[model samples]
Target: MTLSVTPPGTSSGPRSGHRLAVRPTRRVVAPEVRRRRRVQLTWALMVLNVMTFFPGAPHLLPIPGSVGKLIAQGALVGALVMALSVNRPLRVRPSVYVVILMTLAVEALLSSLHAEFLLGALFRACRLFGFALVLWLLTPWWTRRDLLLVRTHLLMLWGIVASVVVGLAVAPGLAMTEDRLGGTLWPIPPTQVGHYSAVAIGLTIVLWMSGLLRRSVALVSVLVCVPVLLLTHTRTALVAVLAGVTLAGISLFTARSRVRKAFAIGLVVFTLGDLTLGSVVTTWLARGQDTAELGALTGRKAVWEAILAQPRSAMEVLFGFGLSNKSFNGLPIDSNWLGTYYDVGLVGCALTVMLVLFVLVAAWFRPQGPHRALALFLVAYCVVASFTESGLSEASPYLLELTLAASLVYSTPTREGPR
Candidate 1:
């Protein structure tokens, strides 16, 4: 046999060709490695996500608000960096909601330029940007929808439990705000704790409906949250939870199937249990006081009046004050819509409304399922809650939940594994 000589760079024989082929294979990651890496990233994201809620935890570090903001921004940036470093094809499909968020962020940045406190404006803008960025980074994980949902719920449960422990340890007396037993971590307002616990309860319902979590576990979770919700004395949280559960219940009941019907029954039972628990808690807490006293809007009307009373030029009316303008009549604006209007003007307010509407419409369009139900409940809850709580404009746990709901609603159903 004549041994034919090959060029230096070219394969000469079968072994040489095999070597060349194996060289490229080195770059191909093993499935085990990929799976391990993905799990690590998912856990990292979960930790970061939970940490975003407790930035004010004194036991963790007695950092100031600005420093906490910086830490959150830094963690998000780091997450984005790690996500980018993953040898996976990133899918960024910006929906209408994403566009609105980006627009609001940019608008806020511009408004910040004219803000009284430039540094504060910058901080607020960074926080908003971080929210958008974190949402975007999270989109990739939606490919593993089941895993994502499970991990999210688990992380949320861990976070709430941790908050309870820390709150008890750090500020046991403060847990009972006035007369109600407000279970929240130190430095977090009871209202916020109620809001977030309600959200967690909502997610638990969604998970149960979707069969991601066991009905028993879900019921227990909801039951646990009821006291936390009631303890905050946050009527808004209760209303929001009721509205969300009602919407979700309608969706669950309307479906013509045995499983869905089972889910509806379970949800109904959970709701009844929650309401009974809430009523007992409320009655016990308000045993000596007039029930009408509990109905007070907590001076939210005064805050709105203060904001409306501010003299604004036409330009300011159209494109209102900056994010740095934190107070109305020396009190923080408690309403999300009012805060957005005060900070970024009418245009921003309009955009915010449109975003909510878009999410609602999107939820309506989603095929009748647990996802649709969850989306509708979340959007409705956020919308109703916004009237009482400053949610969307700020970097709080509520906003995090909103972002997750939005992503879930808008994300396409096709699964694309990392390349």
Candidate 2:
């Protein structure tokens, strides 16, 4: 006798024989559920990006250095991937700015051939490309602007808390120098901490002005960041913060009601007055003056002179000596523009300037609003900070924040009203 088995979800019967009946069920998820899931996933990714900067994360998690970098890079890549999967079909037409950025990346890679360490140069170039990709992917999330802003600030706040906690746990005394508060989570430089604190203050101001943050909370955040900023004692950071706050005030005053305008103007005047009259501020300025009067720029001027002294071929001058080339006679080139010129040459420098100018102009032309003001503030900070430190050169938390700001500025619709 031959016997046959029926497949699942199928029914079969012989004239008088017993038969099995089955039904198929489809598990349909509600659209709202899916949306919530995506939003949560995005928040998690943002947190991961921020946590990558925690000095203790890699060690605490027992992840290798290389693996940690890969994880960070993967998080960015994963965000892009998820966005592409859920969003409308990717557009074939590319933005002009993106094309220019791509060209610059290509130039950087080519210039890397002349670097002292080819692998290092390639790695740097790749990391930059990763950042560009991540930012580009963010352009599609303009519809979720509120969520994006909240997630970003939340992560930033977490970073601040983590830095303080880690600093206090390890080398608290070393973290804060005599008369200066430069506490940092290990692996984060004191200067970087200062820069972070400055930016945080600027962000808090904008958020509070926009009414996205409560006045009490904003005041508390500013108070918390100020001592850290003072401790860092980084002159460039101080200057950048001042420039950012001034720009923010101007932007707010221009776009707000008469009452708000008056407040904005008053705040600006107060900040300027404080910088001028505060004893500690004067002391900082005096220290800088003493260094400048000696023609050393606290050793930065000497580094620049050494770099300029090096004999270079026409090709090298036009296209740079390559990334990470140590032709500075054992001196560190502390300025981003100068470092770019040394690493990538005139062409690279021009590209960097164009990129910065484009972002600045874009932010300036944006309709008067808090987002526009914040973008302008960030761009101003980066521009001023670059003059003293190579803040824009590498893949760090600070650079990541700048990239996010630029992406937000570029992606935001010009006609949208203030949030």
lDDT of 2 by residue, 1-419 (tens): 99999998756655457554568789999764564456446535543553344344212234556676576657766766665554445532245455656666778778888776789888777756665555455455533446464346545554665576476557666555554454344344567667777888878777776667787887888887777777667778888888987787678774556428647676798898897778866776665467456467777887887777878889889777666732366676878888888877889888878777777888888877767777787888898988867735444454555654565565545322111
TM-score of every model versus the real structure: 0.77, 0.75
TM-score of 2: 0.75
C-alpha RMSD between model 1 and the true structure: 8.1
Give the whole-model CA lDDT for all candidates, comma-separated: 0.67, 0.65
For model 2, the local distance difference test gives 0.65
Model 1 local distance difference test score: 0.67
In angstroms, the error of model 2 at 54 is 11
Tens digits of per-residue lDDT for model 1 on 162-267? 5764676577675665655544443455666677678778777766766667878877777877767766677787888779877876776656354467666767
Tell me which residue pairs clash in candidate 2. 180-231, 181-231, 181-232, 320-345
Runs of candidate 2 with Cα error greater than 4 angstroms are: 1-94, 142-154, 169-171, 177-186, 257-277, 285-295, 325-330, 393-399, 411-419
